[model samples]
Target: MPHSIPLIRAAAITPIRRWVEERGEDVGPFLARADLSWVPADDPALPVPLRSVVRLLVEISRAAGPDTPHRIVNGRGGFEIGLIGRAAFRGPTVRDGFARIARMMPAHCTHEIFTVALSGDGLHIRDGWAYDLGDDEALYLVQQYVASLIDMICSVAHPEAPRAERVEMVPHPEAGLNHLRPWLGDRLQPAPLRALDFLVGSDVAAQRFPKGAQERAREANGETGRRIASGASLADQVSALVAVMLPRTTPHLDRVAAAAGISGRTLRRALRQNGTSFSDVVERTRAQIAVDRVRNDTDVSLGSIAADLGYANQATLSRAVRRWTGQTPRSLRSGLKSRIEPGKPVSETRLSK
Candidate 1:
């Protein structure tokens, strides 16, 4: 069952409208288009179909300016945070690279929570949140858009280098992983569950972007401005965190409420009054993840994957999977094959600094 729409926000309206206008065929399911009555493009509230917009911006930024080797952040106010990484942390050290990422891209860059990790194999970045509660289309667009941005970064950073690295996210179920593998070739992860593995050498990891890039990426308004204009209400907070963080971790009542900076009791009462429950919402999300995982990857070993989820063993994981899909992992992956989509260059869009 689909989650019913909540009270739409004035802030989210413009992005919703732009999404419907530009790529609704691809981005329609999860996002609700904005009501024109709320705001027009003339208004600061006018949002673009941002996932698409950001992807396009990253693509342009990859090709923009001189080949000075800079990092681009998907900053707010209609533009990318171009090359602030090089300026922010000036060194060819993993610490500098990470500091650059931390300074520039906090979780919720463009309204989503993203985490970056350094695994032994590569730089593993995970993006998903139970917040940003639009619709499935908005979620899908955001996911795909992030993946493309990752791809653009790798292309510009490594160029034709074979052993450099690649970036990707866990994609939608219907579209398979073959496409990413083709573009990234040996660099791509073997599974849809592949995290953003930027396999770089110690030297590249230490290398920082150009000078002055960090300050340029810095937004003028501070976190206070973000809070004031955020348009998040007490109630919307619960759903928002659920939308973003839920994808990263299992959505427990306490966890969801905590993300909203609210009490679990208050969250339960709110959801109850609103005709839903935390458990119901979590189960729904889990169901979606289960189906997507099952339908998309034949190679994602269920037994070993039990650990990917917070399961002690396959039995615990299998129980939940069966409840959602009415099929065991063996049955689910039996006839499964992956999917792919044609790669297209996103349009050029530049924002004022």
Candidate 2:
């Protein structure tokens, strides 16, 4: 399953910059490394973007903690940086530090971080870091970070797990260069996307978290998420839920519940416990998603966009847009677009005929 798509991808990158500053490093080292073979940020040959891959490596490194090497790339536009750091270790039974990386990862990375959650009792992680790194040093740093995260996850796992979960490097044909079967008896997959997969027992995970910690974990770094959502404001809960499921038509409560694995009643109860109602949720989400999407994606045509949002006609869509966001569709588009393109009228609809 796709692990929290937005969080994983949205990690804060400041730590990477801080890490780089500490090392007195330059992008040159990555270019000089002989062992590193990288595809460019613009490489069309691969399915994933180099910058994104680099971004993941950096998040894992920072989450691993301090005193580790770091690497970064400066693409002309929208490029990313990387860093490597030490892993956190706690508890004797959880001997593998790598497993802890997997466990704690949700706390450190963003919602959009590249992650493929394997379904199993225990997790085995393999990893890959992408770069247009023309140098071996940068690539090596990426490799070490990947290896360290795997090590962290494995160390935290229960000593004897019944089944294993395979995680491999995204860029590898058979996981990563460390393809050899481990003597330690890990069940590793030599597949690309599984490189970061870990062998973790869900039962153990249940026991590891503190009371209410998982929910807290979910809220961590999630600045946009609501705190205790239900009764406070139906509009707010609906807004938050829609934010979580935008661009995908119909933010059905049941679907949200399924994504969260909670029953509709229970989900409603939790929302109520916090402060809101289900009807409020539906309205808030629909309104917010509509406004956000219309303002955010310029490429989508107005009519198609309206239809995707379940509006019967452009006029109804326009009215609803006005209700949610005190502005007409044209005004909304222009205002939002102006932030990205300076001086150009932000809204596409020219007000004067």
Candidate 3:
């Protein structure tokens, strides 16, 4: 059985849409090309295909010409201030806000995980996810996400409180680096991982917002979190858990069942009721992760990706990639590279798996 990849909130792409529209570019064709009917303005919580959103970002980049990413970042109007944003905004201090954002990210987007850690004199905010995007798409997403994050922090915190000192992104060509430097500053360092570091000023952690704001935000976030959790089906929960676990090891059905506080039989019954199986979810997740790594993480070798995904070896992953994409691992990588280059027409790049 094959399971469809889960959809993400349409609100995630709101920034890109707004940027394009502000530039006098009609966003309709881009949305249509990404298989989206309309941009959901009324219901920001509405779900849309994640791949489509990725495709839209790539298309927008192509249309906006050189240094498009910088323009998009600078053009960001404001944060949407959803449940997570509200919780962060209501926090007593900038550090507290980062903590709230970290805690609430999983509830908002299951595919990606975020973490905040204190380094010597600064704080590091790391974004981790099983790669499920091509090179260009991944770069666009990371850039957009980091920019929005910094913008949100700056918007809520005191003007001088939380200043980003540096950002680390996956390595790219000189052209990409040139575009990134203006917004990210010359402090940008290309690395094998994705993260952004902020220089926590002395005033950040102790600065407090208006009284009662924290309580109100927390109450609202609690309700939103509960609604999200309650509405999620067992299979959805299992799939999210599997995604988190896949990077470390091949998750077993029994282990996943236990993690969900259900027996194996019960887990199987729940999945069957949801019209899926454990194996189907696992295969789909692995396939998605493999493709992402192959297309984005050019630094990681095939054997390393196979091991990360719990395959026996590179040969096994090669076979799996072929079955999933109707192309070999090498061919898929090559094709994506050719399709993602700057100046390439959007129609040449298909989002379909």
Identify the candidate with maximal TM-score.
3
Question: Model 1: runs farther than 4 Å from truth?
Answer: 1-100, 103-111, 120-122, 131-141, 151-168, 190-203, 218-353
lDDT (tens digit, per residue) of candidate 1 on 32-95: 2211221233333222223333333223323332111112222222223223223133323333
Weakest 10 consecutive residues of candidate 2 by summed lDDT: 75-84
In model 3, what lDDT does residue 71 have?
Answer: 61
Give the count of colliding residue pairs in each prediction: 28, 61, 0
Best by lDDT: 3
Which ranking of candidates, highest lDDT first? Answer: 3, 1, 2
| Candidate 1: Cα lDDT at 172 | 34
Q: Tell me the tens digit of each residue's lDDT in model 3 across 73-106.
A: 5533234535565657666676777777788775
Model 2, which residues run further than 4 Å from truth? 1-183, 186-241, 296-299, 334-353
Q: Candidate 2's residue-wise lDDT over 1-353, tens digit each? A: 21111222222233343344556754233322310123232322121222334544443444442224212321111112111112222322232333444444433332213233434544334443221332333344454444433343332343333323433323322233343244223454434432244445555432342223233333333223221222223334345445533443455565445433456676677666655555555555556557777887778887887776566778877877776556787888887432222111122221111
- Write down the lDDT of every candidate, Cα atoms only: 0.41, 0.40, 0.59
TM-score of each: 0.39, 0.34, 0.57
